[model samples]
Target chain A: MTDRILAVVTLNMDIVAGGAPIFFARNQEEQVKMARYLARTLDAMVHDLENGVYIIVKH
Target chain B: MEHYLGTIIAGTLAGTVARMVMLRLDYRQYPGYPHGYLSHLSLGFIASALGAVAIPAILKPDYTAVTFLALAASQFREIRGIERKTLEHLDENELVKRGSDYIEGIARTFEARNYLAMACALLTGIAYELGRAPAAIIMALLSIIFVRTFMAGETIGDICEVVPAKLWFKDSILMVENIGFINIGLKEIREKITAEGLAVLITPKNADARATIHDLGQRQAMAHTVTVLLGTKKDVDLPEFTPLARIDPDSGAVGLYAVPVERDIDALILAVKRTPVLESARSRPLKTQAGRMAAR
Candidate 1:
């Protein structure tokens, strides 16, 4: 994995990237799963930027 | 009988004096008060006795006494272990925890100091046996000075320059010297930062210093030192306002942002300059030819 930003997702009742809604997770567990799935699919790693925001990247 | 008395007195006194000379209450107040000094002094005496007796024991044709020096050496190793455990336990309660590297360095220093004391006593004993009491006293002074110089380590000021920089807000983002520091969306928090927060720019003199400053642990140590000297305005809930260091991607200059209770920039600069280069994060690029050329 390389240090390259895949997407910047924010939690606002759902996960949003680039001001567009991507996925709707009911709880923290679902959010984690979605993050992992997106990371694995994009060949990136997920990092929590806190304040309910996560950045997926490949390094 | 007079000769034996001279050796014992000279050796033991030299070791004890060395220990006392080295003892200091620094930033990490480990051996703090009366109790701590009491224990160290007693151990110093024992180490002194062991080293002092070495010369006389060999001269008296009693080889068994020398074996005790080996026993003393083992005990000193255990002392290192004890120091590490003590510091590690105390670190949990510290606001700015000393990293494992710093703790390990301290523990090694404590052990080494005891060994130096033993060596000092031994040297004084030899000098007394060679040229009487005056020679022994002279040797003790020389050894103490040698140890003092050897133990003195480098501070941050030797490797870099620290100067105050104004904090800037561009589109709700905090910037220091054109470096994107942090996002400050809240108007009140941004206002407070603009009013009181202090920013300092640290520029490394060479590649090695740049590598050292880039280490996250080193930056944390610098922030911790500043907080200890000036006091931080951070609370448990106020994570956003926590002291942060941002490095310029191109130039490798570090920018420190902190809102301290004491708003004295001069004191902050002095504190940062005096911060010891953390042993854990120290970079030594000058050791390699390619690295040396790049640094030059």
Candidate 2:
């Protein structure tokens, strides 16, 4: 079993606001892909404001 | 005695006439943006006359400067308490549906200030006979407080007094507080740990603060400023330090990171972006079957 169980899962996209679904990927790549997949559909605000923010992931 | 009566009559008439003019303009501008600016202008003029009265009132046996302040402060504090619907969860289409609502909201916020600024100006005129800067310092300090927060009690004077920035940061912050209304007092904090100079602001929405009727809409939309102090920098200020946070291509360093921490926040940000939805909202042009085949 992975030590990093799905504590909280959330997408880093703002289009859906706070209602998007997310899953716990075990690694960084999983995190990035999960981010890209969910993010591509939304029109990302291209400001430097959201670059390093780890949007709260839902459990 | 004659001048005092004249002043009162003059103020009342001026306020009434000014309001009538504004109301007239307000009527004309309808079906477009609401003409709220009229309130600010009229209120300012009206209050200036009333402020002249405040001077004599202050000298009376019962009236203290604080009494005038209490009246204005209480009135303003009451106005600051207002209802603001959270449009944060709204999508682009919804945003457009209530698009004009934002402007209406902005106008409301401005006019509300007109009320207090007018009250203060009126009080100033009344207080004029008292002394130099009698309440001027207090007024300046109070203005700093109100302008910074756009709300009472959250002013920089209050904040700085309670929570002084690190000694190194005190001056830049004073500059910020001094700049006051010129810059929205919304602040975020970001710091860079790498040689690349990456800056990430960590501003979690304060979920615990009370949402007063006065605290609605405008206060929620933006923060005043962002303060970043990594370890210590004895030699820098806000503007001087701000540039350090921007990306420098020549040096291959990332300047600012714009991510939210709470997943819900990212969802919120992503959900609100309108550029994607406008395309989704409209129907595509119809194509003839033959034309579709030709294109394909």
Model 2 misplacement above 4 A:
A1-59, B5-36, B39-50, B56-69, B83-255, B258-296
lDDT of 1 by residue, B9-54 (tens): 8999999888877676232425467876777777888888788989
Candidate number with greatest lDDT: 1
Among the numbered candidates, top DockQ falls to 1
lDDT over C-alpha atoms for residue B148 of model 1: 75
What range of 10 consecutive residues in model 2 chain B has the weakest lDDT sum?
Answer: B159-168
lDDT per residue, candidate 2, B200-276, as tens digits? 22121121111110122212221111111121221112221221112222322211221222223333222222111
lDDT of 1 at B126: 97
For each candidate, report its DockQ versus the true two-chain complex: 0.06, 0.02
Weakest ten-residue segment in model 1 chain B by summed lDDT: B24-33
Top-TM-score candidate index: 1
- Across residues A1-59, which tens digit of lDDT does each residue of candidate 1 receive? 44666665556644454642355555667666776667657745455655666566654
